[model samples]
Target: MEGLLTAETLYLALGMLACGAVAGVLAGLLGVGGGIVIVPVLYTTLGFLNIDPDIQMHIAVGTSLATIIPTSISSSRAHHKRGAVDFSLIKIWAISIVIGAIIGIAVAGQVKSPTLTAVFAVIALIVALNMLTNPNGKAIWQSLPDKLVAQPIAAAVGGFSVLMGIGGGTLSVPILTLFNFPIHRAVGTAALFGLLISLPGTIGFIYNGWGHPSLPAASLGYVNLIGLALISPVTMLFAPLGAKIAHSISKKALRIAFGIFLLLTSIRMFSGKLF
Candidate 1:
């Protein structure tokens, strides 16, 4: 325990600060929980601490979701003020998404780090391709599918996002746009989805990882307290700024820039699968 405390050095603190800053902006601007950024950073940080490779991805994913809780709140509120959030959709998708999240936790516990990383890479690639395309262009459909069909998709988004250590915005935003939602509205609604995906995700991870022998100091299951404390505050501070940028900026530029970032991130995630 003493050595674990000693390992919480300046390097970890600085790394988390920088990670948080970028992640915060991405959260608000991209309507994501910023897990694409958080997962990798936390993974690397834990590696530097000599954490068990078997559990590193689990901790990173859990911590990333934990941090997303507040960031989604901040980002969603900002979008709501702009009339971009759809409360009806929120009500419709809430239950199924939460159920999916719980199932995701169960699945994650059975997988190793490589499998989780692979899933993240593949999904990130898909999202990057969607973003690079004309995200706000003509839609395939006139409106969302009926609730019976849509609920299952919502469940999948929640579960898949848990595997990727995300807030579900990366998946939800694209899905919403496919159903003819405006870009801003999709982004806003996805911000709420982040909350739904993350709250249960964090709890499930903690519960699943309880009494794990490999966790770091100040860990609650797979969630790292120090990392959460260091990251969430800055993300909250910047999420509103990101939301402001999202509303004010040109959609095209946002799409292209975010697309490129995800493309690179996906590639990197793919390359890091062995670790």
Candidate 2:
């Protein structure tokens, strides 16, 4: 480990720290897995290190999902303390979500890195647009489907979120709110879903990426322990603070700011492949 600390490694470490910090805040603030922030940044960082192109995005996705495990637990506990979590919803959706996540992991392993990047970009753009136009959940469909209808949607949410290395809140929150679930409860429940998604997702990535060649140092399959080492603690530290702030502040401005950020991030993801 000591011998690996060249200038490049130092720079990467610093970058990971920043990514972890940002992800923590977002996880708390948005009840997300922070994969939306971490994936693109990791892609950039690994690109700089000139790692194997074939595995770079896989590493990013795996690491992001792995970090989400602890981050989601922390954020979910905070929200649960405040009575924001709806355990019934979690109970209702749990099995389906897990099954969908397994399917997503299987599919991700078969897809190319560029295809994954494109999928992330598309999803990010949709999320940004939703946040920008419906910051308060007032713009689009305002009701959730019946359980018979919801089961399939829930599965899709889990599958897509796992594929994108996210916590599922990006899709879950909106779906819940449309069904008239309170926003806070939706956010908290989504945090739990992040845990569900990340655990199986991370395991799947590790299994899928096992024995892949030229993985970066400290990688366990596609999951980079070094990245988790740099990121997890910081993210856990900051998540409660973000949750506290979310409760106290007006989120409209924050939503707008985050929307712009997501837009730019999406553009970067899309353009990276092009150039």
Worst 10 residues of 2 by lDDT: 137-146
TM-score versus the correct structure, for each prediction: 0.94, 0.93
Model 2 spans > 4 angstroms off: 1-5, 139-143, 273-275
lDDT by residue for model 1 (243-268), tens? 99998887777778778888888888
Q: Report the C-alpha lDDT of model 2 over 243-268, residue by residue, as the tens digit.
A: 78767766466566657777888888
lDDT of each: 0.88, 0.84
- Name the weakest run of 10 consecutive residues (lDDT summed) in model 1: 266-275
Residue 185 in model 1: lDDT = 88
